[model samples]
Target: MPIVMDVDALMEFLRREFPQVSEDFVIEEVTEELTTVRLAVGERHLRPGGTVSGPTMFALADVGIYLAILARLGPVALAVTTNCSIDFLRKPASGRDLVSKTRILKLGRVLVVGDVLIYSEGDDRPVARASLTYSIPPRA
Candidate 1:
C-alpha cells in the first residue's frame, strides 16, 4: 500500500505528541517496504554493564514499528502497542547510536504487525531483534 504520511509529517507529529523522547529518534528512511530509524544513544541509555539497556532497545523497536504503521496508515496518534517481543543478541556499542530497520509484515484494518532489527551504529552485526503488534483505533 502507498504511504499516507511521509517522514517529515510523521516526525512533526511525533515531536508534538511525544516530546520526551522525540529528540532521541531520527527517521533515517521511510519507504513503502521499509523504514529505518536511528536512536541517539547517550550515557543515560547505558546500564551498569556499560551496555545499552533492554528498555532502551525495546523503546526503539516500539517506535520503529509505530512509525512504520503511521507511514502507511497516516497520523493515528491513538494507535498503541498491544504486544512486543525482543531478543537481545549482542551487547551494543556505548559510543555509537543504534539503528533500527523495520518492515511491516501485516497491516490490517484493526491490527498491524512488524519486525525490527537493531544494530549498533557503525557495527554490521545486529544487537537485537524485535517483533511488535499494534492496535489501530477505529476511524471516526
Candidate 2:
C-alpha cells in the first residue's frame, strides 16, 4: 500500500502523541518498502561495558516498526505490539547511534507483521534482528 504519512507527518505525530520518546528517535526515511529510524544513542543507552543495552536495541526495533505501520496506516495511535521476538547477534558499537531498518512482512486487516534489523550507525553488519506483530484496532 502507498504510504499515508510521510516522514514529516510521522515525526509530528510522534512528538505530539509520545512526547517522552519523541526526541530519542529520528524518522530518517519512509518508503513503501521500508522505514529507517535512528536512535540517538547517549550515555543512558549504554550498559556496564559501555555497549548499547539490549533494552535500548529492543526499543529501536519496536519504535521502528511502529513508525512503519503509521506510515502506511496513518497515525493509528491505537495500533500496539502484540508479540516480538528478537535476537542479539553482536555487541553494538560503543558511543555510536543505532539505526533500524524495518519492513512489513504482512499487512493484514487485524494484524501487521514486520521485521527489523538494528545496526550501529555506519556498520554493515546487523547487531540485532527482530520480528514483531502488531494488532491494529478496529475502526470505530
Candidate 3:
C-alpha cells in the first residue's frame, strides 16, 4: 500500500497529539515498506554509564514503528503498542544521532507488527533491534 501520511503530515499530527515526545523524534522518511526516523538524543537520554539509556532506545523503536503504521493507515491517534521486545546489541554513539529503519511484517485490521533496527548515525551495523506490535483502534 502507498503511504497515506508523509513525514511532515505525520509530524504535525504527532506534535498536536503527543506534544511531550514530539520534540525528541523526527520522521525523516516514510514509505509503504520502510520508515526512517531520527532520535535527537540529548544529555537527558544518557544513563550513569555515559551511554544512551535503554528506555530512550525503546522510545525510538516504538515511535518508529508507530509512525510507520500511521503512514500506511493515516493519522490514527489511538493506535497503541501492544507488545515490544528490544535487544540492545551495542552501545550507541554518545555524540551522534540515532536512526531507526522500520519495516512492517503484518498489517491487519486491529493489529500491526513491525521490526525496527536502530543504528547510530554514520554506522553500518545496528545498535539495537526491536519487534513491535501495535493495537489499532476500531474505525469510528
State which candidate has the highest lDDT. Answer: 2
Residue 133, model 1: lDDT of: 93
- Candidate 1's displacement at residue 101, Å, is 0.4
RMSD of 2: 0.6
lDDT of model number 3: 0.93
Q: Which ranges in model 3 have alpha carbons more than 4 Å from their true place?
A: none
Give me candidate 1's TM-score against the actual structure. Answer: 0.97
lDDT by residue for model 2 (1-140), tens: 99999999999999999999999999999999999999999998888989998999999999999999999999899999999999999999877899999999999999999999999999999999999999999977
RMSD of each: 0.8, 0.6, 0.8
How high is the CA lDDT of each candidate model? 0.94, 0.96, 0.93
lDDT of model 1 at position 10: 86
Q: Please provide, for model 1 over 1-140, each residue's C-alpha lDDT reduced to its tens digit, 9 standing for 90 to 100.
A: 89888889989988999999999999999999999999999999999988999999999999999999989988889999999999999999778999999999999999999999999989989999999999999998
Q: Which pairs clash in the backbone of model 2?
A: none
**Cα displacement (Å) at residue 68, model 2:** 0.3
Which candidate tops TM-score?
Answer: 2
lDDT of 3 by residue, 1-140 (tens): 78899888999998999999899998988878799999998999999988999999999999999999989989888899999999999999878899999999999999999999999999989999999999999997
